[model samples]
Structure formats: structure tokens, C-alpha cells
Target: MAKQGYHHGNLRQALVEAALGLIEAQGPQGFTLSEAAKSAGVTPAAVYRHFAGRDDLIAECALQGFRIFGDLMNHAWNDGRPSALLAFEATGRAYLAFARRFPGHYMAMFESGLSPSVTPDLAAAAARAQGVLTRAAAALCDHLPEGRRPPASMISAHVWAMSHGVVELFARGAPGARGPYPPEDLLEAGIGIYLRGLGLIPADTAPDPSAGTAPDTAPADPAA
Candidate 1:
């Protein structure tokens, strides 16, 4: 039990942190509301003051997770500088990095079973993050003929799916599971092939080959 007279001015944040810890230890469905309260060092009733119920708390955690995830992706994108292709590769690496660095938040954001209809904040945050990929795809498609260019939405979805698949397969830290290459390399190779298929990158125009290894010397701009 928490000590008597404990005063948490930011009990809401405390509860959310505790909930993330619990989610990490046990899957999203593993813990109870009361257990969360106990872990937060607050009374069960105090939790109700911030969240309507277990679902509400879980939703908030997922929402926060998406916000942080979005920010990380945005930073990784760096506004498509130096070159769109290189920036896109950085964004894919960022996705895998986030999954590895914040396993708890990653699981809560992607595996919580909370739909956007039920959590609009989560939906919005996810869209912002995905927008980075959409924009990168748009930049890539710019090189293709207008008639041949794939829809930005399609490109975004394909790249997002590919990145997520590689991260889950190679970066999730599964016991005894190993891949032939690093997650970033796998993602880069897959994106290269996908871009080729879309005709976004011309086959005759020899690929940079070292595009993914290019240094990020673009100007600093958080908005980008």
C-alpha cells in the first residue's frame, strides 16, 4: 500500500505510467483496474476520478502511445530532406526502433484491441504518424508519370504494412528467432523492391545502392 498522506498532483500520469508497466509485465488483457490502482500507489476510487473504467484507462494508454509513436516517426522523417528516398528509409528504421525501445507502449498501441471509433485520440495520433509515410510516398511517386503513379494511400499502406511486418518478425525479440539481416536492412530491401514494382523508381536509373546508408545532414526543423 502507498504511504499515508501521499499527494500525487499528477495522479493521472502516475496511473498511466503504472498501467504501462502492468501492460508490459502482462499483456494488455492481463491486469485489472484495482491492480492498476495498487501499482499506481493510489486507491481504486482515485483511479475513477481520472478514468471512467478499465477500458477508459486502457484507451488513454493507447492514445498516449500513439502520440509518442507519432512524434518519433515524425522526427525520424525529418521532413523528407537530403532526399525523400533516404528519409523514407529512416522512417522505417524508426518504426523498428520504437518497437524495440518502447515494447510496452508499442504493444498497447497496436495490440490493445481498442478501435478508433472507441478512441478518437488514438485514431488521430495514428493518422498523424502515418501521414509522414504518406508524404514520403507522395515524394517518391513524384518521379513517376502522372498516369503511372500509384495512389499515395496505396503506397503508404504498403510501406506501413511492410515496415510493421519486418519489425514484428525481426525486432520483437522472440526467443531463438533470428533473421538473415537486421530489421532495418530487411525493411530497406523490401521498400526498394516495392518502389520498383510501383514504377516509382525507374529500373533503368541505377539505384543509389547506398541510399539507406546516407548521412542525415538536413537542416533541423521539428515541423518537418
Candidate 2:
């Protein structure tokens, strides 16, 4: 069905939204720029006015994803208030929450084949998102012995890997999955264990619930 009352002023935004919906239903490679234009209620040629090609549109989507992900993590971090460890854990929760709430954006940000080098905008956006994780990791290292503290980059990668693994394996909804634990609980437990193993926190320290609850899922903001 052709979109009714579509205006040129809204065409760009419409195309982006359409692309996201397509990316959600199919992987990044599953749709084309022409299809996005059709979904947006515009002619295929209209897409070129807003995006150079499919890769450009995908990069824009990924850039927007990173910006949203960064904001969520930064809000959760809250400048490491109360305690650094607690704030760091909150960031982890935010990561999982973002993944669950915006699976398409999440996939575009990480699983899309586009490399950061493809676009400066995408690279910068990705860096900002990763910077949030790096800052949290640095905060977590405060309790470690000076000599034992790992590089923030290493810590960030380790935590990110763990969170990503858990999200992909258990949280994304597998068939017949009958687990009593929620994804947040599993994430907190895994992060706690990993921190303890790194000696960043004492072996007996329990995870703190007072740090911050995961942010409620918000409507996707594609403006970025």
C-alpha cells in the first residue's frame, strides 16, 4: 500500500524509520535502499537524496544506535556516585537493557558487517559508546592494588564480552528456555564473579542492588 499524505519534509526521517523496521525483520543485508524507500512511501530515487546507498543508510542506523547506547550507559553510570563498583555494575545492566529493548539497533551497532573505518561519523559514535564502558571499567579498578589493576581497555573488553555473550545466549529468547533467572540477574552474577576473579573487589563482596535499577525501556530516538 502506498503511504498517504507523505511530505518531502518527512521523507528522510521516514526512510530511516523504514530501514530500521526492515533491519529488525531481516538482517542488515536482507534489505535494499529501494525497499527502504518503498516502505517510506517514497520512490526508490528519493533514498539517494538522504543516503548515498545501502551502506550509508546502515552506517547512519549504526551511528544512531551507538549514540542511544552511550546515553543509556552514561545515565546509568551517574558519575560513579555512592560507589564506583555499584555504578560500574549499573552500566553493565544498562548494556543488557539496551540490547533487550532495541535488538535491531543493537545488532546494527555490533553485528552489522560495516566497519568503523567506513564512516567517520560511525567511528566517532562507536568510540563515544565504548568510552562509557571504559570509564566504568576504570572506576571499578579503583579498589584494585595499583600493580594488579588491569588496563581500562582490557577490563572494558572483558566485561563487554561477558555481557554480550550472556545476552546472545540466554536473553534474546531461545525456544523452550526455562530458566528461573532473568537476564539482569545472570549479568550481575557474572560481573560480580569476574570482578572478584580480577581481585578488583573482595571475594566475599555481594552485588549491590542500591546502585541503580536498569532504566525502563524508552522509545527509540533515531535523531542521532
Candidate 3:
């Protein structure tokens, strides 16, 4: 997206961009509306013409983020083409890609502490994004015995938690930043371990995660 800052009729978008930049650089509550207005090259008072306040601006950012996230996850899922397991893995990779590609939006959507119910649109966007993962989880786990199968939502939540942990704990840090063992390898290995535990992947058939312990994953600032 081009940064159309403070254009004739796009002040709303400009302020949103400013808020996203601030969120990425200084966390959600670290900056003020006045600062955001300054960054967007507008008067602080001009912000109210499009948004009620900073939270409103942040909500817009979250809204946009969910839209983009949904698209990425959906694309990665790709109707579970080739193989459900492979597609699911791609979706996991896309999570890291999204956080790297849109740190501002990622922070706003997940780290901002904004209520999921802040707005109907925000809520709907969030649900749609979440639904993609659930669908993928369901597709991948469909072969499980009915009594043994975990709920798709539960599987999706587990994968989401693991992916989020990798990003927060390893991907963003110093020594872990594409180090001797990249976060990507950690995530894939972890996922493999998880699926093996679930019997979705048999140990003998699963890739020897030990072999790919090297940091050979593709370069991405996340999706770079």
C-alpha cells in the first residue's frame, strides 16, 4: 500500500498509517494522537474529522490488518491443495510472514489490547481470519478417528499459540534472529513434534527435523 499521507480526502488513511508506524516503533500506547497527527503532517484537531480518538484510529488499523491477514491465510490454505499437511504448513509460514511484513498491523491486531468486539466490522474481520485457521486445521486433521479427533478450533488455537510464541520469543529477538537455529526451523520442528504427538504425523514418515536443524529457511523480514 502506498503511503498517501494527508491527501485531500485521505486524511483518515494517513492518520491510520501514522498510528501503525507509531505502534510498530513504540507499541500501542507509547504514542499520542498529537504525535500521530504530527507524523501524518496534520493538525491534531484534524484527526477528529475522521476518527473519534486514538483508539478509533487504532481500531481502523486493526480492521485493515485482519483483512490482510485473512487474505494471506486464505491464500496459504489454498483449499488445502497438494496436501492438507503442506497447505497447513504454508499457513503457519504465512503467520510469520504477516508479522514480518506488517509489524504495525500485527501489533495493532494482536498486541493493542483492543476488544475483539470494538466494532462490528473489526469483530467480523477477526472472526473471518480466525475461521481460516480452523478450516485448515479441520482439513488436515480430517483423517483422525472421530473419537480421537480434537476439535478443529482447538487444533487451530494450538498452532496459533505456537506460531505467536515463535514470533514473540524468537523471531523478534537478537540471538534468535535468524541465528544458528532460525525461528522458522524451530516452528516447523515444533509443529512436527506437535503433529506427531497427535498421531497426525508418523515419526518414521515425518521429516527428520534434526536434519534441518541448520538455519536454511528462506529469508523473510517476515515475508521478505
Candidate 4:
């Protein structure tokens, strides 16, 4: 049992908020209960008055991370971007931006061990975030052939997977040689690639390859 201090005013909220800051600064593995308590200006035992232990606290922190993620998506959707592809791209950029801004929370959102099971709050947050993407995908689907709607779900999944993979790779850095590609360029190319796959735009819509000197020609690969 956690030893409680005589005055635990808003200790629970303070502890959670402090843990969020710590997680955003240090990765999940970096924080300790004693450290959190110290940061909260309370006794180590006081932490347990709110969270069960390190795992419980980590879980709550991660849940909060997902909530933040959902908020990011909601904000992007509310921006009233016109193109479905543009809206989708904005959301992708938002995700990567959040990850860059809060590396700890980003990791915690995906880290299973810290909060392996999705609590009700986390689940709702995740669903809302996904719903944003699903609606965008549905909009894209409207432009697609009837036969393609069923596959939009898979395409949506792939879009998220691609964004997540690309961001994670960029965060980790390359093994050797100088990192040539910029993050924004990589993300734009990734979104373009997925958009092409969804048929929302032509694959040949990529930047003019000939530095404005050449006439527009059909894509080399007609299958695209």
C-alpha cells in the first residue's frame, strides 16, 4: 500500500500530468516512481495513492498519450482542408509532427508493455482517431470504382502503416552514410504513393522530372 501524505490535494491529477511530462521527455523506461513523486513534490509513497505502481502509472500515461493523439487528428479534421487527399496528408503530417514534438508520448502510444491492453478510454481515443481516417478513406472511395470500396479499408490500414513506419524509421536515424532524405519530403512522397494506390490521383502527378524543360509524357509504367 502506498503511504499517503496528510495533504494530497489534487495529487492524482498532478501525478498524472507530471508523469506525462516525464514520459514526453524521457521514454517510458526512463521514469521511476520515486522520480515522479519528487517531480510532483510529494513523497514516493504518495504516488501509489493514485496509481497502483510503475506499470499502472505507465499505463495511465500511455492512455493519455492516445487521447492526445486523438485530439491531434480531430484538430486536423476541423481545419476544413478541401481535398480528401489533402486532408489525409494533413493528418499524416499531424501524426509525424506530434511524434517529433512529444517523442516519449509517441512511443508510449505504441509501446505495448507499458499499457499492453487498451483501457476503455484509450480504446475510444484510438477509435476516434481511426474514424477520422476512415471517413477520409470513404471520401476517397467515392472517387474510386464500386469494385474498389471494399479494398479501401485495406488501403486505409496501409496508409497508416506506411506513415507510422516512415516516421519511426526517420526518428531512429540511418545505419550508415549521411541521411539524404528530408522528413517532410519523405512524408509527402509516402502520402503521394498511397494516394496513387487509392486512385485519388494519377501516379504520374509526381513533380515534373525534366526540370520544366520536357513536355508531359505518359508514365513509363502504364499499369500504374
Highest TM-score model number? 3
lDDT over C-alpha atoms for residue 117 of model 3: 99
lDDT of each: 0.78, 0.80, 0.85, 0.68
Tell me which residue pairs clash in candidate 1.
none
Error of 2 at 58 (Å): 0.6
Question: How good is model 2 by TM-score?
Answer: 0.85
Q: For residues 1-224, could you state the per-residue lDDT of candidate 1 as single tens digits?
A: 33344456888888887888888889888999999889878789999899998878888888887888889888988878767877888888888888888877887877778775586677888889889889888887776678887899898998888977887788778621578787777887888788767766544344456795545443232212
User: What pairs collide in candidate 2?
Assistant: none
Candidate 3 residue-wise lDDT, 154-210, digit = tens: 989999999999888877745366556877788888887887788776654334578
lDDT of 2 by residue, 1-224 (tens): 34556775977777777888888888888998878888888889888988999988888888888889989999998888757887888898899889878877887777778897788888988898889889888877766578888899998998899989878877775421535677788888898788778777666533457856644443221111
lDDT per residue for candidate 4 within 59-126, as digits (tens), equals 77667777788789868765436656667677878877777776666776775364434467767776
TM-score, prediction 1? 0.83
Best-to-worst order by lDDT is 3, 2, 1, 4
Q: Residue 5 deviation, candidate 1, in Å?
A: 8.7
Q: How many backbone clashes does every candidate have?
A: 0, 0, 0, 0
> Which structure is stronger by TM-score: 1 or 3?
3
User: Looking at model 4, which ten-residue stretch has the lowest summed lDDT?
Assistant: 171-180
